[model samples]
Target: MKRVWIAVALLLAVLAGTLSHSFYLNSFTQELTGLLEAAEAKAEQNEWASAEELTQLAHHKWDEKTAYLHILLRHSETDEVYTSFREVAEFIQCQEGGEYSAANARLIAELELLAEAEQLNLKNIL
Candidate 1:
C-alpha cells in the first residue's frame, strides 16, 4: 500500500542518516584522539611548545564542530569535553606533566566514549 511504502521510505532515510552521523563521529573522535596523544607524547619529551600547539589545534577543531555536536549530542556530554579541553590547556600552561597527562587521557577517553555512545548498536536501540 502507499502508506506502507511511505513508512519504509521514512525508516530507510532515518537509518541512512544515523549511519552517516555515526561514521562522521567515529572519524572525528579518532582525529581528536590522535592529536591529544601526539600532544601527550610531546609533553612527555618536555616539548611544551609543540604540545601546547597540538592541544590548541585539537581544541579549535572541536570548537568548529560544536554546533553540529550540540545538535546530535546532549549538551552535558559536549560541555564535559569543552571543560576537559580547558583543564588540559591550563595544565599545559603550568607545565604540569602529571596533571596534563591525566587530563589529556581523560579528554581522549571522553571523546571515544562519546562516539561509542552515538553508534547504532543494539544497546543504543534499546
Candidate 2:
C-alpha cells in the first residue's frame, strides 16, 4: 500500500510539472507571436524605428536559450517584410546623396545571421 501511494505521488508530481511547462511555453509563444505581428506591421508601414523597436522587444521577451530557435524559424518566413522596409529606407537615403552607413549594413548582417541560426536550430528541433 505504501509503495502504491509513493508511485501515485510521483506520477502526480511528474504530471503537474509537465502541465506547468506546457503552460509556460504556450504563454511565451503567444507573446512572441504578438511581437512578430507588431514588427510586421511596422515594416509594412515603412516604420523602421517601430520595426526595430518591436524586434528588440521580441528579443528581450524571448527565451534566448530555447525560445529563440523557434522565433528565428518563424522570423525567417517574414524576412522579406523586414528587408523591404530596410531597402526602402536605404533607397531614400541614397536618393538624398547620403551613404548607407556601415552600421546599417552590420544590422542587416546580424539579422540574417539570426535568421540562419534559427533555421538551423529549427531543423535540429525537428
Winning model by lDDT: 1
Candidate 2: stretches off by over 4 Å: 63-126
Q: Mind sharing the TM-score for model 1?
A: 0.98
Tens digits of per-residue lDDT for model 2 on 99-124? 32333334444444444433323463
Cα RMSDs of all predictions? 0.6, 9.8
Best by TM-score: 1
Clashing pairs in 2: none
Query: TM-score of each candidate?
Result: 0.98, 0.52
Q: How does each model score on lDDT?
A: 0.97, 0.51
Backbone clashes in model 1, listed as residue pairs = none
